[model samples]
Structures are given as structure tokens and as C-alpha cells.
Target: MKSLFKIIIITVIFTSINSCKYYNFTGAKPIDADTFQVNYFQNNADLIEPGIERIFTLELQDIIQNQTSLNLVPQGGDLLYEGEIVDYRITPMTATADQRAAQNRLSITVLVRFSNKNKEEDDFEKRFSHFHDYPANEQMIGARLTAGLDEIYARITQDIFTESVAKW
Candidate 1:
């Protein structure tokens, strides 16, 4: 009876492991894709921030690479991501007693076009946006700008990853 119980537990463990071959904790479902490419994301926003295009492009590439097993390719990858920074805007979010701005929000929007060579049906074009809020008294430059950009990029890139591969 003890031997039978051990065998049952071992079989169950093996079955659970084997059944999760296609399951990724990150929720990425790249399926048949083995490689991906992120093209230069040009900054087409009306309020252009210098070097943001390069930074945003790298962020997208890094997120996909870090979360998935897909290799990065220069071209002709199984998955392709190309897009532009469509909007970068700062707006006053809250006002003080005197009607002065008390808080501000920095928002960034990216238009992405994802193509899956292995699965045409998975292709999509969408816009992902995110924002960071900070005190209105602080100028959006140097460390403040970097922090806001970092937060915004992290969210937008993750959303792109989810839409393009997570399939959740």
C-alpha cells in the first residue's frame, strides 16, 4: 500500500510537469516563434523629447528579451515589432487653492505594429500609453524626467509584450 502511494505521487508530479510544457509563468505565448526584432521607434510626437525615441526602442527590446526566450535578430525574425512614439504630453492634473497646478502628469503613447511570421493571425497594430505623476513645482528635467520616462516606458513596453505575445 505504501509503494502504491509513492508511485501515484511520482506519477502525478511527472504529469503536472509534462503538462506545463507550453505554460510560461510570464504568460508569454510565443508559440512557434524563436526570434524577434524591434525596429527603431521614431519620435513622431508633437512635443519631441531628445533621445526618447532611442530609449523607448531599447526598452521595448529589453522587455521582450527579458521576458521570453526569443532571440533578437536584425531582420526577418519570427516576430517583428515596429512603431513610433505618437504622443508625449505633460498636463496639469490637480490644482492648488489658488488655482495653480499642484500636480502634473507626463504621458507617453506609442503606436506599435507587431507581425508574427509563424502565425499571421497573431499580428496586430495598437497604441499603448502610460503616465507618471509628479509635483508641479518640479521641472521635468534631468532626474525627474528620467524617472517619469522610466515609469512610463516600463508600463507601455509591458503592455506591448502582453498584446504581442502573452495572448492573455
Candidate 2:
């Protein structure tokens, strides 16, 4: 019985180790290189919100910094991301019998230019967008606005991270 127990334990341990050999402990698998830089994202939308660009820029930096092991630099780094906010608008999503808006959708679109110094082929310029919907009667101020923006920002940042480093 003792010998049988030892054999079982050894097999289980070996199986687990072999299964995880190619798996990255971190959720993200950064490229072979290190160091990354994100330039301040500029708002290029016609109806620009006063501080949207700043908020977005900071959020992206925070997510990337937390997820990856790369160092953030000011100038060129092994990886670079720069972009502009291209669109910010609210559109009526649904209308009631009175022809009034029942729901409004707030959408934001960002264009990103990414470059990998080590691998030019991996570089890409793409657009990422997200939105949130709220009742048209509700004024999009205070907590309402904050919640809407937070939801959009979270999705956008995740998409950006997946494209830039996570390789998802």
C-alpha cells in the first residue's frame, strides 16, 4: 500500500508539471523583448470632452504597467503605443411611441498605432471602440457619467492590452 501511494503521487506531480511546461504563469505572454512606452493619447474628436484624453491615456498606462513586466519609458522602447481619440458621440438607440428617445448610447472610438522595435511585422494600426447605454431621461452627470465612462474604458483597455502584448 505504501509503495502504491508513492507511485500515484509521483505520477500526479509529473503530469501536472508537464502540462504546465508551456503555460505562462502570468495571464499575459509578453514578447521576447522588454520595456514599453505609451505616448499621451490626444483627443481629435470634433466634440471633444475637456479631459477624456487625459483619463484614457492614464488608464491605458496603468493597465499595461500592472499586467506586464516591461519598464515604461518616455522615449523609444522595445514596444511603443501612441494614438488619438477619434470619436465621442451619443446617439439615440431606441425610441418610444412618442418618437422620443428611450435609450441613448454613448460611444468612444480610439485609433492606435503600435510598433514593436524588434519585430516590424508585428506592428499595427487599429481602431478600438466601446459604448454604454443609459436611459434618455437620465442626465449623464455625476455617477451616471462616471459609470458609463468606466465601463467603456475598461473594455477598451482590455482590448488594447490583448492586441498589444497579450497576443490574443
Candidate 3:
């Protein structure tokens, strides 16, 4: 009886592990293709932030690489991503008792064009945007700027991933 119980437990464990072969915790669906390319993202915003375009491009590539098994290629990949930064703006969000700004929000918007060579139906052009708020008293430079950009890019990149591959 004890041997039968052990056999049942081992069977359950093996079945569970095998069933997860195609499952991705990030909710990314398996693709028919294996390679991806990310072109340089141009900064076309009215307000230009130096190096942000490069940073954004790298961030997008990083998320896809970390979440999927696809290889990154310079060109002629099974999947392609290209875009431009459309807007970068800072605006006041809330006001204090004195009617002064209490918080400032930094917003970034990117226009993306994704092409799937293997499945043309999955191609799309979309805009992803996100923002981060900081105290009105603090300047948006150095570490503050870095943190804000990181937060915005993280969300925007994730959204891009969901739209392009995850289908969620």
C-alpha cells in the first residue's frame, strides 16, 4: 500500500512538471518564430531628453529577452519593433493650500510599430504611455530623473510586451 502511494505521488509530480513546459509565468504566449529585432527609437518629442531614446530601445529589448526564449538579431528577424518617442511632458498634478503645486508628474509616450514576419495578423501600431510623480519642491534631475524614467519605462515596456507578444 505504501509503495502504491509513493508511485501515485511521483506520477503527480511528473505530470505537473511536464504540463508546465509551454506555460510562461509572464503570460506570454508561445510564438511560432524565434528571433526578434529592436531598431533604434528616435526621440521626436517637442522636449528632447538626451540619451532617452537609446535607453528606451534597450529597455524594450531587455524585457523581451528576459521574458521570452527569442533570440535578438540586428536585422531580418522573425519579429520587428521600431518606434519613436512622441511626447515628454511635465505637468502639475495637485495643488497645496496656498494654490502652489504639490506634485509634478513626468509623462512619456512612445509610438510603436511591431511586425511579425511569421504571423502578419499579429502586427500592430500602438502608443504606450506612463508617468511618475515627484514632489513639486524637488528638481527632476540626477537620481530623481533616473527613478522617474525607470518607472515610466518599466510600465511602457511591459505594455508593449503584452501588446506585441503576450496578447493579453
Candidate 4:
């Protein structure tokens, strides 16, 4: 009886492992897609920050690569991601008693066009955005700026990933 139970357990594990192609714990099921492509995300915002495009492009690539079992290809992939930075700006978030700015919000928005060759109905174009707030006294530059940008990019990329792949 012990030997039979062990056989059953092994079979269950094997079946679970092979349940689906490109199955992952992140709730992404890429179906028959074996490769993906992320084209350069150009920064077209009026207030462009140098290298912001590169930062966003690389981070998106990294997230998809880390979360899915798909090869990163230069182009013509089963899954494709291409977009442009549409907005990058800082606006006053709060005002002090003296009528001076007390806090500022740095917001970034991206327009993405995602294509799934294997699933034509699944292709979509969407806008993803994120923001960070800082004290009005602090200049929106240097390390603080980089940190804020990084945080914003992380959120945007995660949203893109969740939409393009994660069914959840």
C-alpha cells in the first residue's frame, strides 16, 4: 500500500509539472507563445528626461523575462510589446498655509501596444501610469529623481505584465 501511495504521489507531481506549456506561478499562461519582443519605448513627452526611455525599456524587458518562460527576441516574436512615453511632469500636490507648495507629484504615463500573434483577440493597446510624491522643498533632480522614476517604472511595468500575460 505504501508503494502504491508513492506511485500516486509521483504521478500527481508529474502531471502538475506538465499541465500546460509556458505555465508559471505568476498566473501567466502564454499558451503556444515561445518568444517575445520589446521594442524601444521612445520618450515623446515634452518634458523629456535624458535616458528615461532607456530606463523604461530595459525595466519592461527585465520584468517580462523574469516572470515568464519566453525567449526575448529582437523582433517578429509571438508576443510583442512596443510603446512610447506620453507624459512626464511634476505638479504641485499640496499647498502650505503661506500659499506655497507643500508637496509635488511626479507622474509618468506610457501608451503601450501589445500584440499576441497566437491569440489575435488578446491584443490590446492601453495606457499605464504611476506617480510619486516628494516634499515641495526638495528639487525634482538627482538621486531623488532617479528613485522616483524607478518606482514609477516598476508600477507601470507590473501593470503591463499583469495585463499582457497574467490573467488575474
Candidate 5:
């Protein structure tokens, strides 16, 4: 009885392994890009931060590496992503009907144009926006605004990843 149980277990294990589904991902489809090239995202807007370009480059590289099987190469990729920061602004949001400023909102927007070099098609082209709210702080408001911008950048990066790597 014990030997029969052992045989059954071995058979089950081998069957499961053999029946594992395999996915054939060729670069022919619009969503199945084998390689990607990310250019340095520039800030063309009047409002600029010192390290925004670097932040975007690093974030994009990290996302592509983690999310997809696509090869991250320095040049000559199947897909190309290039864009710029189009807008950055801050506005006050009112909590009361009287329009008294209760919080400040920092917003950032980026325009991404993605293309499949191998298939000769535009994969995605759109603008992504992200924002953050900070309560009114009289002291060091600039610092708060900068922190808000950082948060906005992080959100923007995530959106870009979802569109590019996640293929959504």
C-alpha cells in the first residue's frame, strides 16, 4: 500500500510538471515587445526641478526591469519611449465655501510617445498626470511643495510603467 502511494505521488508530480502551461511570446504582437529603449525624459516646462530627468530615467529603467521579460539595453531596442514633462503647477484648494485656502495641491504632467520599432507601429501615446495635497504649513512651505512634487513624480512613474510594461 505504501509503495502504491509513493508511485501515485510521483505520477502526480510528473503530471503536474508536464502539464504546466507554456507561453510563446513573440515580438509580433503589439503588446509583446522584446526590448525597450528609454530616453532621458526632459522637463520642457518653465517650472523645473534639478533632478527630475534623472528620477524619471531611473524609475523607468527599474520598472522595465522588474515588470517585463523585455531586454533592457542601452540602444537598439524593439520599442522606444521618449517624452518630456509638459506641465507643473501648484494651486490652492479651498475647504470652505468662502474659498479660504485650506490645502495646497502640486501637480505634474508628462507626455509619453511609445512606438514599436520592430512592428512599425505606435504602441501608446498619451499624457499622464499626478498630484499631491499638502496641508497649509506656514513654515517652510517651499519644502512641503518640493516634497509634494516628489510624490507626484513617483505616481507618474507608476502610471508610465502600467502603460508601457503592463500593457494596459
Candidate 6:
């Protein structure tokens, strides 16, 4: 009798926990979306950041795959995401008094399109971008610039994922 009572109590607790649902934290009601598709982002710009296309594609994929319970599909997914890297530039933001060198800022912009097949939501077309600054004195500017661009891409991808998956 005692063992049976303990089992019943445990089952009740587990059932209550699983049944509880909230609109916050997870944000929005649990969507029925189960599959997603992401296309390669084209780079049709004069100024190019090497590997920018690959970075954006994979980061966007990673964010959606990790954040939500969405299965990534090659074709005919419940949700579709596609976009392009519209701009990539490295410009001197500031110069030292000597004018020899100073600081540089690297910025990138990506235009994203999101669509849900069954829902009548906005189906947003959004541009997400990020920039990073570094002193000219830093050695191996090429490597640092690459790293900076990667960080920016990560941030931009995160923003996109938060909006599309988290519904925030």
C-alpha cells in the first residue's frame, strides 16, 4: 500500500509539471511548426568578406536548429528562411594624430526572409547587421578581421533566430 501511494504521488507531480504551460520565456504559444528550410545566401556585392556566405548560412542554420524544436529539411519545410549578404565593408572609423594608422571598423549586413506555410503571420523580410572595431596596431589584421566578422555574424544570426524561433 505504501509503495503504491508513493508511485501515485510521483506520477501526479510529473503530470502537473508537464501540463503546465506559459506564454513567456518560451515566448508565444507553442507553434506547430516542425520543419524548416534555409537556402544559401548569395553574395552579390563589390566588397566581399571571404567565407561570409558560408558563415552566415551555417550560423543561421545552427541558431534555428539549436534554439527551437524545428527539423531542418532540404525542401518543402513548414518554415522557410533565405537571404543574402547585401553589404560588407571595412572602413577607417578614426585616425590617430600621426595619420599613420588608427582604428578600423568592419561591418556586415544581411537581408533575411522568413515564411511560415500554414500561418498568416507577417512573413518578415528583415535586414540584420553588426560591426566590430579594432585598433590598427593589432597584429595579423587579416585574422583579427576574420574573427571580428565571425562575431558579428553570430550576433546577427542570434537576432534572427530570436525573432523567428522565439517569436520575440
Please give, for residues 1-73, the per-residue lDDT of candidate 6 as tens digits. Answer: 9999999999999887765443434454456688999999998657975677987898888877776667999
Candidate with the greatest TM-score versus the true structure? 1
Tens digits of per-residue lDDT, candidate 2, 1-168, equal 999999999999999888654445556764766888889999999877788899899899888888877888998788999999999998999999999999999999999999999988889999999999999999877899889989999999999988878785
Off by over 4 Å in 2: 1-26
Better of 4 and 5 by lDDT: 4
lDDT tens digits by residue: candidate 1, 36-142: 99999999999989999999999999999899899999999999999899999999999999999999999999999999998999999999999999999999999
Model 4, TM vs. native? 0.91
The window of 10 residues in a row where model 4 has the poorest summed lDDT is: 18-27
TM-score of every candidate: 0.95, 0.86, 0.90, 0.91, 0.71, 0.80
Error of 4 at 87 (Å): 0.6
- Compute the lDDT of residue 57 as modeled in candidate 1: 93
Model 1 segments beyond 4 Å from truth? none
RMSD value for candidate 5: 5.0
Model 1 accuracy (lDDT, Cα) = 0.93
Q: What's the best-to-worst order under TM-score?
A: 1, 4, 3, 2, 6, 5
**CA displacement after TM-score superposition, residue 133 of candidate 1 (Å):** 0.6
Residue-level error in angstroms, candidate 3, position 40: 0.6
Model 2 weakest lDDT span, ten residues long? 21-30
Task: State residue 32's C-alpha deviation in candidate 4, in Å.
Answer: 1.8
Deviation of model 6 at 145, angstroms: 3.2
On residues 45-85, what C-alpha lDDT tens digit does candidate 5 reach at each position? 77776776777777777766665677887888887888998
> Which of candidates 1 and 3 is the stronger one according to lDDT?
3
